[model samples]
Target: MEADEKIEKISSQTLISNSPSKRIRIRPLTKASLVLRGTLVVLVLLTAYTFYTIDVKDVNFVQGMIGTAKNVKVMFLEPHLSHFSFSHALYQVMITLGLAFLTTVFGAIIAVFLSLFAAQNLSSKRVSVVIKGFAAFIRAVPTVLWVLIFAVAAGLGSVAAVIGMTFHSISYLIKAYSESFEELDKGVIEALQASGASWWQIVFQAVIPSSISYMISWTFMRFEINFAVAVAMGAAAGAGGIGFDMFMASSFYYDIREIGAVTYFILVIAILLEVLATQIKKRLKVNI
Candidate 1:
């Protein structure tokens, strides 16, 4: 009788503890979730405050929209270069390409040597850490800022642009190249070591050959980035390219047609570069 009574009591206790009402309650929210919610709330409050405080009493919304439409029509429908010829624009584009190419080549050469020391599998832990940390710091700063800094010494021109772009590219490529190198198979490295091969021999025989495809891909990607940066540097650093001509048209002359013409040129060139890169990679069968 006592055992039966105890069993009934335990069964009743379990039923109370595991009630449907208790199961319906939510699990505890995590710290990340709480912070995300808080950030959203803060942003919403700030946006509301900004909208409340701004003065738009004198604004003419309809006129502004009509003016914008007219400007767009003028730009796209009628685009012609009044100040510069087509050949000049093409030459300027070539200059920009040259800048990008030079920077990629120089940076890749330097990065290859530096990354050999930065790869953890191939180099000492201390050296790898130092190289990676330094590269990170260099990459933290904007490429434009680096160009301006070099401009202080080299003056604002192609020289400053090339040096600054190359500086940033080296840091970027170091991290990329080192990571690729580190991904090499440990078994291959060990076998080479056991066979009495020197470090350079092992690198040439196994590492470079294995990672060449990836390296080429990374280098080309960097080239594309450098080309865009060079265009911007042309206007900002006085590097003199199609970008400079566009800046002159838009800012000095206030010519929408000229701006549109420059935009078309840049767009066409960019498309050609993409096609070229794709074809080259396909021909070489470079995956990844």
Candidate 2:
């Protein structure tokens, strides 16, 4: 009788425990949710105020659109091949390509070293912090300011553009490369270290080979940014490039067709880089 009574008591407790009303209730909105909602409201109001204060109505939107369309049409109708001969447009393209290439290469090389110092796991905390701070400082300054500084220091030319792009490239490359390094499989490094491999050997034999795809992706992305910056720097520094040509064309209100042509060329270059980089990433992914 006592055993039957205990069994009945256990059965009743289980039924009650399994009931829906006995389950713990969770609140819909958390503290984080409320904070995010408040932040979004503030951002929306700020954006509205900013738009209201900016005299966008004073701008000739319709005329500008018509002018741009006409210029684009003229560019397509005109012989870009002929313009390549005397206009130095081709030379400017070459200069921009050369500067971007050199800056990316040199900056990537320097970035590899800097990234080692900046990586928290790879270096002392103080060294990593210092390197990160330096990278941030470099990134904080505008590329245009760097161009002007170098232009005055180097006496106005492609050289200044090259230096400015290189500085900016270092900041980007270091951050990207270090993050890539951090994401690497730590097990491989640990295994290599366990087998009596030196730090340099482990890095070269394991880390770099594994991170090649990410490095390539980042480098190509930086190449696109560097190319755009190089063109802008060329214009600012009065260096010979499409940017300079475009600036001159704009200043004199010359054939808008020429300006359009330069813009088109830049677009083509950017598209090409993006396509090529995509292909590279695919190939790397497949190979891996």
Candidate 3:
């Protein structure tokens, strides 16, 4: 009888404890939620309508690929020394690499200063807002367009490509760096201030030290982007690089093998960069 009573008491207590808390309550949607849903629905409809209007009557999947089978085979099977000499391809690849490196370094140098002022935690709200707004304006324009605009003054070539890529890189880095710096512990900031640390001292000792890893990581990511842009600008802005060779093969003739070789080189370089950045991040143990 004692055992039966104890078991019954435990079961009754469990049931009572769970009764109120275990019930699932549906979230009530407010006007803001309704507006957001309505906006999403409209955007989806617009996207569907746009795709529906495209002309696809001439498209044939098998027929299109069948025509390029030999070229494809040569490209995939024979990646090198098919169309261009090895030395020439190497030169172009080096140019692309150098361009990316230079742009990344230059942009990162400028972005560090800009980010110092852009961060809300470090600067006045008005100044941060203004700086951010300016960066947004610059970023809103496409990379190619920026290059083209600079081309008018700098003339078309590697110079234009470098300037354009750097402009976008700075804007990108500033945003990333500011956000990382902003994430520094507020309590740490308060302690530093209480210890009579000046603004510059706080930033140099606290912010930069804490966020340097993230800064490096963001810069590496931007380098990858700038590299890709350099390739495209080489073709578009007459900036001589591997992209120029690829562009010629694709635009001028049916040089399938050359296209394949250049594409392979680019693919390898991109993969290597990604691997390097990943390794650095892992080694540094970057929190951001």
For TM-score, the strongest prediction is 1
lDDT of 1: 0.93
Q: Is candidate 1 or candidate 3 better by lDDT?
A: 1
For all the candidates, what are their Cα RMSDs to the real structure? 2.4, 6.4, 7.7
Model 3: which ten-residue window has the lowest total lDDT? 75-84
> Which wins on lDDT, candidate 1 or candidate 2?
1
Each prediction's whole-model lDDT (CA)? 0.93, 0.82, 0.90
Q: Relative to the unseen true structure, what is the C-alpha lDDT of residue 96 in candidate 1, on a scale of 0 to 100?
A: 86
**Could you tell me which 10 consecutive residues in candidate 2 have the lowest summed lDDT?**
78-87
Estimate the TM-score for candidate 1.
0.91
Error of 1 at 70 (Å): 3.4
The segments of candidate 3 whose C-alpha lies over 4 angstroms from its true place after superposition are 1-61, 68-71, 286-288
Q: Model 2 over residues 48-109: C-alpha lDDT tens digits?
A: 99978878666687988998787767866672433344447767887888778999998999
Residue lDDT tens for model 3, 1-288: 999999999999999998977776596678998999999999999999989896768878588788679668988787655567888888998899899999999999999989999998899999999999999999999999999999999999999999998998899899999999999998888999999999999999999999999898999999899889989988999999998999888888667777888988899999999999999999889344
Candidates in descending TM-score order? 1, 3, 2
Whichever of 1 and 3 has more TM-score, that candidate is 1
Candidate 1 contains a number of clashing pairs equal to 0
